[model samples]
Each structure stands twice: as C-alpha cells, then as structure tokens.
Target: MTDGLTLRLKYLCGRYWRLLVPVLVLLSAIAFAGAAAGVTSDAQPQQTTVETDSMTVETTLSTEATVTGNTTLYEQNDTLTNLPVYLRSATPEVRLIAVTTTPPDRTVSVTQQIVLRLSATRNGEVFWRDSRVLAADSTNVTNGSTQTTATLDVQQLARERLAEVRAETGNVGTVRVEVETIAVYQTDAYSGRTSAATPVRVTERAYELETPQRDQQTNVTTEQQTAAGGAGGAGPLSVSNGPALRDLGAGLGGFVALGLAALVWLTSRRIGDFDTFRQRYERVRYAEWISRGSVPATGRHARVPVETLVDLVDIAIDSEKRVIYDVSKGVYAVVDENLMYEFRENNDGDMNEFGFVPITEPTESGSTEKTSSDDGAETAAAADSWFDADTEPPDHDSDASPDDGS
Candidate 1:
C-alpha cells in the first residue's frame, strides 16, 4: 500500500512539479498568518465589560380624594383613594404627592419643587386663572429618596372659579386644576469626552383634575404623569471574533496543506526527458509511415533490430513498405524479402539494441522455422507469414495511398 502511494505521488509530481514551490510558499504563509491571528486574540483579551459610573432618576405622582361632608352617599366621613369619579355634593378633598428616587451609591443630594394652578377656559381662552407654590425646593444630601405633598378642596375651588367666570361673561366654562412637581438629583456619574459636568438629572410629575356634570351628579376625575432621567459614563463593549470552530478549522487546513507540500517535495521523483522527447518527435515526423496494429508472427525471415524509429524508417523506405507499430507490444517493424526490421522504445535506459536469433533457411518445399530464445518455442513456423493473403498487415497511414510506400 505504501509503495503504491509513493509511486502515485511520484507520477503526479513528475507531471506537476513546477507548481510545487508556489503552492508550498502560499500554504506556509497562510499557516503563519493563522498562528499570528490566534496569538493576537490570546494576547489581547476581549473587553467584556468596562468600569462605568451611572445614575438613574425617576419621579412618580400620586393623588387621593377624601369626602369632607356628611351626605347620603357615605357615613360621617369617607376618604377615597384613586376613585374613578367623585361627586361634588360629597365635598371631596384632593391631595397630590410627588416622589423622586435615585440609586443610593450615586446620590449626592436631591431637591423637589411643587406648583399648583387653577384655570377656567371657554373656547381655548382662559378668562380666570389662579396659581400657588405648594412646596419650595429643598435638598437632602444624605439619601436618594425625596417626597412633596399638597392638599386642596377641588369641588369648592372649581365651583367658585366657574361661578365668577359665568357671572362676568355669562359663559359656563370648564374648570381645570393642574399640579406640577420638579425634582433635581445630583450624582458623580458622567459620560462623554469633554470635562465631566456635575452629573445632574431633573424629573417632573404632573397631576391634573377633570369634572363632568350630569342631571343630578357632578363627577371629578384625576390623572397623574410620570417622568424619568439618567446619567452614565462609558459602558462595556460587546464584540466577538466569531466561533472557535471556524478559527480552528482554518488553522488546521493551513497546516494540512503545508504537510502535503512537504511530503510531495521529499518523496516525489520526476520522469526524465529522454522518453518524452523521443515519443513526441517520432510520432510527429514519421506519422505518415506508421500503422497501428499487432505485428504478425515471423516465418522464413530473420530479425534485424535497430536503435530508433529513424533507422527503422530508413529500412522501410528501402524496402518500399509501411512501418507497422504494435501498440500493445510497443514495437515498430517492417517486413521485406527475408528480413524483419524492428525498433522499440527503451524506457529502462538500456542502450543495447542488437540480439542474435538463429533461423533455419527455407527448404525445397519453401518452408522455414525459427525457435524463440527464451521459451524455446518454434513460433516462426506457427502460422502464415506477414506477406501471405491470410496474414496481411493493417492498413497504411491515412495520408498514404496503396502505391505510396514508406
């Protein structure tokens, strides 16, 4: 098995050895590049995460209504939280609360400011409006939590304000009350390329009131708004060089290619030029005189061996006959009178051409016989001769006619 493999490899190298150097160089370079990439990836570990400073600020608004009168709809007094609707006859009292939150470690100080406004509008025109500062801004440097609160009689305020607008312009307008809260949070976290600004985040919360009157019931609706803010420095990077299997495959492929190149270089033997040159030159120059077939067994004739096709063709031209090339045996021959001239390729580099073979002369009955040197068989008397009608040779070359010998 190993010998067969070596022989095949040698044959391939003989046919394609010119490409070996360039292929080897290419594979070696690729192997080196793969090794470099692996080393680079190992030396510089991927940045999975970066140390970052960050702070988040969130504000929430909450409101509740309490019944301030003894009416048919309640006991002595009832306090309601987050009611879908409130009746004015119940004399509901409303309270608005705002809270701001931040991370504990990132918080330095936080302050909140609250403002409330009451307005009456008709056709997008505000004819009557009132505002009050419910809570002044105050900061607490110790903690991250801050809260602010305000209270008002929403029914009484809306009734009075709407009545004044109706009395002056004789127009019943919708009454709106709004409360806004602002909170500022201080932190040390910052992001960007410039000098870090005092990382300050501001958040707002709004609470609004709405009223709808029926035939016998007047309802008030409350709504709250939420806001958020944040500040942070640079964060981690998410990057990758793809799957490990792909890298391994590429590296191993480069190595395998290099190994193959080395094996071919070490074990291959190129075929020499002598046989190749002879086959090409003879096939082209003497194509017209050569005929491809099996050569018939000789009888009553002597064998005259030659060294090359040129010498064989010279004898064929003199004999006025065509040269017969036996493809299976790789022998070229010509038969004339009593001599069979022959030439064969010497692939083993042996230069000897002449071999002596004893032949018996024809007798009175025109019969001859010859014995093979190795097998001792009388093969020369086995059948009809090449000139006989039953043992005629193959057709001459396509370019030559019947009378165009040689």
Candidate 2:
C-alpha cells in the first residue's frame, strides 16, 4: 500500500530473520518426526500380523463323535482329517472306523495313522494297559477320487486283558479307563503333523465278562507303559504362538507417542562423526547376526532406510569394503573394483594413494586416421590459426626490446 509501511515491514524481517529461521526449522523438524513415527509405528505391526497368520496352524480335539459327512477343508488343498478320537471300552464290542477320503491335492501320497491306547486304573493306580495301532488303510490317489476304510475290532484286544483289566473295574474306588487316540499324518510335500485327541474317559460303563478265548497275549511291557504316559512329542501347534490380530491394534495410539519420542531422540540429538557411525553399524550387524532369520536380507546396493542404517559411515566400516554413496540414487554400494578407471588423466597422486595406477597400453580401438598432407609446418600453422580468434596479438608499434641492440 504505502512505501513507509513496506520499508518498515522489510526492516523488521531483516532484523530478526536469523532467529526466526532457526525456530521455523525446529518446528518443521518436530512436525516431520512426529508424522513419520506415527505412520511407521501404526503400519509395522499390522504387516507383521498378516504375515504371522499365514504361517500359523492350530489343532484342537473335537468332542463330537458323529462323523459329519465327507467335508472339503481348505478348498483346492482338499484337506481330509481322520475321525476324531472316541472312547474305547475294554469289554464292549467297539467297532471303530478309519475312512481315508480323497483330498484335492493328492498328486502326492498322504497317509494317516491313528493309535489307540487303553489304560485301566483302580484308585489312581494303573494295573493293566494295552495300545493298538488301529487298522488304517491310506492308499495313494492313483486314478480318481477313491475311498478306503478300516474298522478296528476292540473285542480281541479286550480279551487279551480280560482278567487284568476287568478285575480293576470291580474294585471299590473309581475305576478309570483312560483312552488316548493320537493321529499322525505325512504329506506328499515330505512334511508331517502329529495331533492328539483329548484323552476320553470310558469309566462309568460296566464291562461284560464273556467266555475266555485263547489268543496270543503279549503282556504290556513296563517301559512301554511309562513311555506312553510321559510322552515328549511334537510341541503344541505353532499357530497358537502367533500374535492375535485383535491384540496388535491395541495401544497403537500409545505406540505412536512412544515412536515420536524415539524419533525426536534420534533426530534432535547430535549425530556423532564417522567413528561413532562405524561403532553403531558394527553393533547393528552383530545384532542381525545373532538374530539371523529376524532380519531379512537386503540386496546389493539397495538404499537402506534411516531406520535400518542409522549412520552411513557406520555401514561403510561394518562392511569393511569400498563404500560408494550415490546421492541422486539414494543408494550405497560396497564394491571391490576400482571406480577411477576413466579418470586416468589426473596428475595429482590421489588416485595412486588409493592403489589405482593408470594402466597405459596400446589402444584396443581400431587404427587411427592418417593425415593426407604430411607437413609439420602446416600442422603448426593450423594449431596457431585455431587459437588466433581468441588470442590477442602482440603490437609491433610498442617499444621492441630497447629500440636498438644494446
């Protein structure tokens, strides 16, 4: 509007610009650090959760006995699970069925084995025990979708322990019949999974004493019974160890604040020199080595994020190789080859200091052109004439040497 107003405004800005510039810069840096930390903290856990879910497996013991019709599990994968373990009585005629159905991906042969262990205890003292690998037939899918079935007859097993097991039930206290059904599966991919059905109690029912029939009676060995009780099998399904997605989203707001504080510490604090970076990078490399699988491999010459590479010089020292930083590409490379191959004309000995000496040799390129006019005088004249336009000529009219021969 007015010249006086403009001049006063410009004077005020000029007087306090030095102080104003630093304040603006500090505020801007704080804002950037807060935004970046908040975004990264919120995003990382969600990505980790999705990856964990894909690799998780969960197995549980189903209580229901009625076989739901042939079900398709993991469509395309065509997962076929064996019958859930059931209560096996010593006396009663137990007819158990093991049906092997066709899975979608049966190009590879798969087999499932279910073992039933029976133990009868009187007053918490086990007197008799017997285990049988239930009759199971798992054939490779050769032609089309085919099914194989095997029925386990428990009557014969019961007859073997007729006297020992039945006598325990007639005792005064609670007679416990602990039946454990464990299933083992092998896939075509050479991987396997072992699952144990919850131990079913077959106690309350009375055992009917029938006429004794002669059969091969292999007395249950003492060690075999002990091994069966305190079994150290595969650990629980890994899927249970995965972090719950519901829990991942919790306290994200708090994490944002914590991450912002960390960002401030990293940004505002004085970043030490190359030696400091070198030490920090060495520590990071050691941490990566100790926890190998946790840190994914970064490809050659990849631009590392600030989160990964705290100080550039630290990475250079940790690698102990020639580190090349391309500011435009925003990537760093640790190379063993000499990079000054094209800069052979430098007279300074700096290149030699780095162990790069120019290798002078006959040119590999094709023959050079020969001049038609082989005249040295003409060549000299052409060189002088080329620079004649840019060079100033010496005036003959000025005092030439001392006007006369002194």
Candidate 3:
C-alpha cells in the first residue's frame, strides 16, 4: 500500500501540476536543507601535509644540477628542453634532518660511522607547513664577509703523497667533518659571485648516540585542534540539516490528495462512459423526486389505457379537454399538482380510445352468464354501487302540479 501510494503521488504530480506544486517545493526544501547540513559539517577536519624526517644519509651527488630559476616551465612550454618544468624546482630550506651512529649507544666504541641526512622541500615556493610548537632556543649567527679561498672538494682514496702530508699532523681519534649544503647556482660555474648557499638548520647530539629508555606505563593524552568557529579539522566539507519543513508539507499534501480520491471512490461506483453517466443521472433525479413526495419523471409517456391503471393513475389533459398519452414521455403533462382529470371510482373503470375495455368483476359463482349491458353503463353502475349493491330510481314529490307529466 505504501509503495502504491508513492507511485500514485508521482503520477498525480505529472498529471495535476497545479495541485502538486506546493508538495514539490516542500520536498525540494527538505533535500536542500539536508544537503546544506552535510556541506557545513564537511568543513571541519583538514588533513595537514604530513612530513617524515629523513632517516638515512646518502653520499652520492648529482653532477648536472637540479635547481631551476623559472616557474613557468610546468605547462606546454617548448622552451624547457632538458626536463619538464614541473619536475624542476629550487630546493627549499632543510625539511628533514636525522643523525644516527653505526652502533647505537656503546660503552666501548672500537670503530663507528656518523651518518647525517637532510631532506628539502620540492620547490622553493613558500607554503605554510603545519607544525607543532615543540621548542625554541637562541642561535649564534655569524656575520662574516670579504673572504677568498681556493679549495678542491671530492671523495676518493688518499694518494701516497697526501697520506704522508696528513700523517705529519699526527692527530689520532680525530675525524674531519664535511658539510654538504644545497646551493642555487645562478650561473654555470662554481664561482663565488653567481651562487648562494641556502640556509640549513643542523642539530647534533650532545652526548654519544644511544637508544632512549621509555617508561612503559605512561599515559598518552590527546587534544583537539580547533580551527575558527570551533570547527575541527581542515578540508572540503558537506552540510545536511535532515528533513525540513518542505518535506513535512509534501507528506501532508500527499495524504490530503489521497483522502480526496478516497472520498470520490466511496461515494459512487465507477462510471465507465457517458451512457452510464446518463443512466445514473436519471436514477438520481427520479429518486430525488420520490424523496420529495412527487411523482418520478420518465420523459417518455407510456400510452397506458385509462382502465389499465383504473382510478389509481393520475391523468393529464390536452387543449381539447381529452386525456393525452405521450408515447415518448411516460409522465403526465399536468400543469399543476391540484389539477387532474378523474377517470372513474371503480377499479376497472373506463375504456381508452384504443378500444381497451376494462374487465368488470365476475358475477357471483352460479351466475356466470353475460349481462345485457353496455360496457359504459356497467362502468357507471359499478361506480355508483361501490359499497351499495342496488341502484334506486328517482322519486317524484306529491306536490307536483297536474301538468308536471308534460
């Protein structure tokens, strides 16, 4: 029943637009409200760009160069022949720095390696990185300039002559530290004027590297990161406010419509066509007249003989003072309810123009013989003797004059 109701509403919306317009609006409002609520809720949790610090050190270096000066090489620009512009980016400040010893903490270290790693941003583009306020400390900045030095830098096995020169220093247990800082080259050569080194943040261990001990029973606390308007998280969002007033209105409208349809169905049987409609209309009209104590009208007057209805049927008259029988209209054409012609008082009263004689009552059982009387005379006799059996002749008064016989 529910499904059928739904289908009926859909059909009515298609057929009766004037009636369903309000319902459509109500439904639309409900849907819109729900959508709006979802949209508003979706604006809360934003996923921050997550970055993991570099964990391992690498010794290899690129010879060609990676830094690019132009930002427009990303599209369909033919000027960039070496590599796609999107792939070319100027390395940003150190994004990750991690250090570890070959052996984790040790009381006696025979020989170990010091590994340092650094990761940088993909582009020199300045973008906000979500970061927690961990710690702040004072840093020593050296402002020194006007220095010239010529040095050759590479990694290779020490030659015999270089080994002898290093051996003269006689410094045992001392290791030379080499720094690898990312530099943006404005020109092709390693000259001092055209290149500038990007600032790097370096952190080193104060004590020998060791695996830190952890307290196993410690409890972890969580805090909500709230943005403006008390909303949490950051990202695209959706808002929905559930069913609105429009939805309720639509539901109410459907019920009202069904109620009206039910009323129409219950009042009468289905009328299939115009013929059925006409028949039903006539029956209702006739019934209405019967309820009001008037004769039911049948348009076609049946040519009923005056004797067939006897004195029970009402009579109509024409202009000639004679009774009229309309073959097409069964009802009498009497002008007023108080006016009608009486046929006879007897049950089988008069004969009609069609030679329809009323049958008189049979005589007493032994006297079945026919009477020598005209049909009209017998009718008058029956009318007079309805209760009395005999008819009396007129009597003359004794005071009559002698010429009265004349």
Candidate 4:
C-alpha cells in the first residue's frame, strides 16, 4: 500500500508542476515591474506642490508743533492825548512830558515817542492836519533819563478841546497817529525833530460829530435841494440859450468835411504826381562818365559795349574815374584803369595765353594782341564735341594705350 501511495503522489506532483511554476514566475515578474515603474517615476523630475503666497501691506504716521511767549513791545505815557483830534479839546492843552524807561533785566528796554496827527474835515475835504509831538517824562527812571508819563489834567484838557472842536465843526473825523522814534542825541534835544529811540505803536480813533439831529436833517434837506438844482437847468447836460451846442456841431461837421477833403486831395495828388514822375523818369539805358585826366587817344569816343560796361561795373569801378556816355552823363570822367584792364582782359585771352606778353601800356597799335575769341570758340567746340561723343562700350581693351584707349 505504501509503495502504491508514493508512486501515486509522484505522479500527481509531476502533473501540476508546470502550472505552479508558471504562476510563481508571473508573480515575480509583476513585483519587478512595479518596482521598476516606481524607480522610473522617482528618477523623473517631481511635480512638487510648491505653494506660492501673495500679500498687501500699508502704514501711516503723524506729527505736531507749538509756540508760546509774552513780551513788552512798546510803552508810552498813558496820559498823552490818545484821544482822536476831533475828540480832543480845540485848545492846545496837552503838552508832551519827559519820557523815561527802566533798565531791563532779562529783556531789552526801548523808549520811543508816540506821534499824533490832528486834522479837520469839512464836506469830505480835509482842510487842516497838523503833527503834534508827545514826549514822555523820565524824572523817576535812572539810566534812561528821558522817559515820563503825561499829566492827566493836560490829557483831559486835550479831550475837552477836541470835543469843542467837533461840536463846532459838525463834521468830526478820525485822528491818525503815527509813531516813530529816532536815535536821541544831546545836540537834538533842542531840535524840533524827535530823538532816536524804538518805534512806537501807532493808534487811531474816530470822534463822532455832535451836531443836533434837527440840524443834520436840515443839512440833508439842503443837500437834496442842491442835487435837484444840479439835475435841472443848471445840470452838466442842460442846454443854455447860448450857441455852444450849435457851434460844437458846426465845428465837428466842418472838421469832418475838411478831413475828407484833405484825404481826397492827398490821394489825388499822390496818384497824379506819381504818374507824372513815372512818365518823365521811366527809361532804360546805360550811363558812363569819366573825370580827371582827359580820355586816352585810343579810348576817346570809344563806346563801351553794353556787355563790357556791365562787366566793368561789376568790378566796382570808381565813380569819379568812370565816364558814362550811354545816358544822363556823357564822357564826364575817365574810365577806371583797373576796370578798363579787366574789360580788355575779359574780351581778350590772358597775357600768359598769348605769345605777346602784357606791357604796362597798350601795344603800339593801341590794341591788345591776344585774341580771346579764337580760344573761346575752340573751347566751346571741344565741349560740344565731347557732349556729342557716343557712350557705347569701346571695341578695344580697357587697359590699352592712348591709341588703343580711344
């Protein structure tokens, strides 16, 4: 039985071996492929999930400043007539007192006089204005011996006087105060001018008129009557029985007519005179004149061709030595020697061109021997021949000699 079982097992294992081997091989291959795929993927650049961020920011700030102080700018006698002139008494009561100042400790000390100006106005017109000096009394102050306060009584008297003046005028106005202190000198003590010091603070005040209400009303009524009178026959536009208007109109009309006549006369005279002058002066001709030495025998009565004359003139011949016979002035002067030479040379070839060289004077025949016409003709003919030459390619070699170059 054992023998039979073993044989049977061996037979079964042999039969299934093919299928089992193939199954194991397939499993190994699958594992290897998966590993290879993973390695390849790792080797390739990774698509990293790199997160990017963006943000906005802002900021703000501020600051502050401050200042403070108390200082004495200027000080004057309090009793001075600070009141408006119109409010001050008419009688000159307030006199300037001595001015003085205490020596300053922490700050500087300055003493100045306050100037007051008094004026009166009537019917909107200033009839009077006067400058009054008010000084300070400095009896108590040491060092600064020129400072003092004005008396109260005097100030009161000034106010009273101003009040009286205002009451009488019935048209009180404001008083202007201008204060300026200059350097004080011992020599200027007696001079009417103010001594030097710091400038004083200027102040102004207006004094009301004391006219009664009834009087004001009456004045208004009078003003209205005057205005009404001015608006009527006596007004600026009112026509009087005189001939002023008629005369003005007549004069204006006469002025207009005279202007028109003068304009027409000027226009006609300008046109007529221009036409007459144009007829008399319009002519075309050349002029040549000679002065100084008499004309040369060869050049006497030698009429320069218009072409030659033009050439001579282009050379700037001296007017005094030039003779113009073509028009206006006839043989009036001698021809410029330089201009004559230029003309002769231009007509004839240069001296070097001819075998006969130039001499200071004309040839014995009194004429240039060098003839330019033949040379000019030859040059012109050569130019024409060159222009007419054919532009075709030559039949000979380009580098050939003259006989062959042609």
Higher-ranked by lDDT: 1 or 4: 1
Expressed as tens digits, the lDDT of each residue in 53-85 for candidate 3 is: 211111111111222334453333333221211
Question: What would the per-residue lDDT of candidate 4 be over residues 308-384, giving only the tens digit for each residue?
Answer: 43444444354533432211111122345423322222322322111122222344456644445666466444323
TM-scores for candidates 1 onward, in order:
0.42, 0.28, 0.17, 0.18
Model 1 C-alpha lDDT per residue in residues 293-328, reported as the tens digit of each score = 446566656888898888888888887888876543
Top candidate (lDDT): 1
**Ranked by TM-score, top first:** 1, 2, 4, 3
- lDDT, candidate 2, at 180: 27
Clashing pairs in 1: none
* Residue-level error in angstroms, candidate 2, position 338: 99
Q: Residue 335 deviation, candidate 4, in Å?
A: 16
**How much lDDT does candidate 3 score?**
0.27
After superposition of all CA atoms, the RMSD between model 2 and the true structure is 32.1
Which residue pairs clash in candidate 2? 277-314
Model 3 residue runs over 4 Å out of place are 1-240, 245-250, 266-406
Select the stronger candidate by lDDT from 1 and 3: 1
Number of the top TM-score candidate:
1
**Over the stretch 144-170, how does candidate 2's per-residue lDDT look in tens digits?**
232222343334444455445566666
